[model samples]
Target: MILMSPAEPGRKFIDSPAMTQGHGTVSLKSRNRNSRQLLSSSEDEQYQKERVVSPEIMCSLKSRIANKQNVANVTRNQLSTSHILDASANMTISKEKEERIRRQKEKQEEFRKHLIAKQQNNVSVDNTKNYCDDTALLTRRDLTNTDENSLLTEDSDLLLNTTKPSNNKSVIIVDSREINGAQDIVSTLRFNHDINVVAAQLDSCDYVVSVRMGVDRKQWSEFSNGTNRAKMTERLLEMCDFYERPCLIIEKDKCKPEEKGRILHWTKYVDKTLVHLIQSKMTLFFTENQLETASIVADLCQLENRKNCAISCPINLNTDQQNRVKFYRSIPHLSYVHCLFLCNNYKTVASFLCSDVKTIMTNGKMTEERASNVYNYIRRTFDTQMLPSNYG
Candidate 1:
């Protein structure tokens, strides 16, 4: 009967055991809450200690935290974008600069090609470079009858000691119709003075010969027409560049009936335009003088036969030229800088100084020490204290 007894479904069973299990769970929860409270108090104490630190130290710590946040933000978002944007800006500027340089180089190259084409056209070329203080005329040169090679000679360096002859230099020449006895004129120009002839080999000399095209009264007049002959003058100057050089036309037969008249008209037209274009371009000489005219002028300025002279600053000078030479001689000489300018408007003084200047250029570039010696000799020879202000 005791074994058969079963517990009812709703009956309270093991009351002590239930209490023990519930008590264990409640104790665990209380222990967790106490641990949380301890952690919160520890955090508060650390915050108070930080507040007691100096402003400098607190600011530094805040900055460090902010910097760390910034780093995180940058790493998470725009790191690649900022790098790409900076690179793009630098590349854009570099591209713009490259484009500008390319355009300038293109223009220079194109101009050079144009000049080379003219040279190939059998035109006599002459490159005249003037260096001096006339600042105005220093860039211009009027060719007369003289051998350019002779002027370039060391002992015959009559005009300049620093002559920078460019391989791509330009030349100027005349184109005149054949006149009576044109062969004689050509021979005179060629033999008497060293004028370039296109028929001559390019390897032998640097020049392009431009043969006179035509001589007709009406055409010459047409070219020479307009106010102050402005239009005609421009055309004539341009005609020089056609062949881009000038040479005498040696005709075996007599000139055409209208040739002389046309030639005469052309000469007058050019004479009218001479003063205007002289600064930028164009050199003029009488048509009758022939092509040798330019060479002759070159020779006169060059000290071909003059002996080299030595000059020095003397304690006592007997001549006025001595003083002028000493003044210019006192200055130091630069290696690349040459072409002397003795500027004075007075005629007599200019003439005397010019003679001395000629002597100085007779020798090539010399050391600064030699200038004094050369100037002294010039002073002794010319006896003037001033130099010429005007020379073509």
Candidate 2:
């Protein structure tokens, strides 16, 4: 309030005012800059957190997508495998169907052939009846009416007594397959004729007639009577026992003329398999199919004066003939064909037997003694033109 040096005091007060105003303005500016820096830093931190969360979400999505893709690939693979399996199964089914169709076709063909045969036979019978009827129409009634029954009876008696076998002379027809009941075929003739049937192991009959089908090119049986193999293979035991004679051996097969060795046939095409059984040792009436050599042997057997003759082909004797030959047939567990291969050789007859002996002995569990006995006996019979003495 004192007016002492007014200019100096006024100047100092004015300078203080100016300095305070400037400081206040500077402080407000500094505070504004600090607030802006804090806000910018907070925005940068939020941006960083957003970047981290975005990457995490993206990675999780990518991983899930990859898993889905892998699952799709696995499903495709499984589908492919299933397709392959189904295709293979279809192929197997197709093959079975083809086989069945083939069999059915064959059966139909056979049935057709049988029908044709029957038709032809019926036509032949009708023609025969027509001819007989024509003959009756041409004949006079008085001639036909007189003593018809008596004349028929007389002719039948004459026919029955006329077809007698040769006296003590035996004719045998050696064949492959055993005929069924040969005795039945000729027994009526024997009963009406003056013939005696011997009960011995080896009996002789007159004029034996034989027939066979599908005989092998070079095979013969070495079995004797009363043996197990012989019993099984000999389907026509009545013929062998009572026929007591050689019969004609008529074989059925379309064998080539140039082919060598004897023909073979077996009974029981699917089962039992009785095969290559020799019916007799007398004569062989070969089909036009056998070779010259076989035909020659058949001729030798057919000679009227001949007593006993071996088959055209060499025979095997060491092994049980029935066992070895029959085994290859339809018989179960009896066929050693898998073990021992086929033998069509026709050497001294023993070659077939000797070569197959080892297998036979092993299969039959036969002793050397038993085998030797068989061998010696078979050799003797083959060499001596006699039935095996062993046949009781």
Candidate 3:
């Protein structure tokens, strides 16, 4: 055995050759065997050192591993909690968006409905204006004719052509309690020379009937002590039953009842009374409520006649009447002119112009010469200007 010094750190140990080696050369097999023995010893020593650990170091290692595992678990839990929070936040945002959208849709729907109603109201007003214009044109044409006698005959013939001749005389039943000088107005009309007008008290007349002027709340209350409105109504109906041609005139203002449905209820009552009376020749009229002037009352009385000529002439041709006619005629002419310019109705336009001119002549507003000139001028304008280019 040869003595060997302890190897230095990080240095490999080298074996010295023994004196028995031949020619100072080591055998390859022997060297390989020695190297293997050295390597085995080192491996055994490393294994023993690894197996012989202290209790404190082992416990420290175990604690360190446990801490690492706890940290990993905490990280996983935090990630899961963050994911849940993100999901809840996303849901809240989505709900808010949905709510806002719903509100926006509702607002749009409301605006649409309001727009439609406004348009309908505008259309109704326009239609009414057009109708008034047409009626006015007809009246003006009749008034402005040059040949009064011929026009009058023509109007009579036209009227007669539409209706069969009747022998029934014009009889008006006068209500005893007329208001606002209505009685005096009716009295004047009764004496007029134009028509064979006959007037009788409400109780005596069968065809035409007029109610007292003060049918308002105070008058109605005083008439029957506010006990029964139907009582006065019943009395009026009974008076109307005796006539062959029954006509009922009610004051426009006084016909209203205090309660909403009372008027409707009263109307039903009147209707029922009429049905019971079995009178087929019944006519109803609602006149102006409050008449301040006698002329107004006279005008109303004229309107009461079945003939259109009844109210055509003003009671007195004062500035007021002239102004009224001019104002009334002017509005319709404006509308008619507008219609003429836009519409292609030459024959109808010519007839309307002729009729208005005739009416003006009959009313003594225009001379025959002036009426004729107006008729010709309007007719020429209608033919030349208002007519369509294609229309002959």
In terms of lDDT, the best-performing candidate is 3
Give residue 160's error in model 1 in angstroms: 22
The TM-score between candidate 3 and the true structure equals: 0.28
1 against 3, candidate with superior TM-score: 3
Query: Candidate 2 — what's its lDDT?
Result: 0.41
Per-residue error (Å), model 2, residue 237: 77
Write the candidate numbers in order of decreasing lDDT: 3, 2, 1
lDDT of 2 by residue, 1-392 (tens): 74548558665554688887987899999999999998998899988877676777899999999999999999999999999999999999999999999999999999999999999998687556544643453243226554433333333111111111324422233221322323432342234332232221111222222211111222123212123454433433334332223333343444466855655544354123223334344333334422432443334334523422212211223565445554333222221221122222222223434433332332222333433444454445444666577877
- Supply the TM-score for candidate 1: 0.18
| lDDT tens digits by residue: candidate 3, 1-392 | 75545665322223224434542455767788899999999899999988999999999999999999999999999999999999999999899989988988888888888889888987687556544654464566557643544555455212111111132223333344442335544555455422223332233222221111111111222332335556655655443332223444444334545553444224554556547435544454444443322233344334544433221211223454344334323422121111212122212323444465654333333244544554565556434576577855
Top model number, TM-score: 3
With candidate 1 superimposed using the best TM-score fit, by how many Å does residue 358's alpha carbon deviate from the native?
31
- For model 3, where is the 10-residue window of minimal lDDT? 209-218
Over 4 Å off, model 2: 1-48, 51-66, 140-392
* Residue 369 displacement in candidate 1 (angstroms): 32
What candidate 3 gets wrong by more than 4 Å, as runs, is 1-39, 47-61, 135-139, 145-392
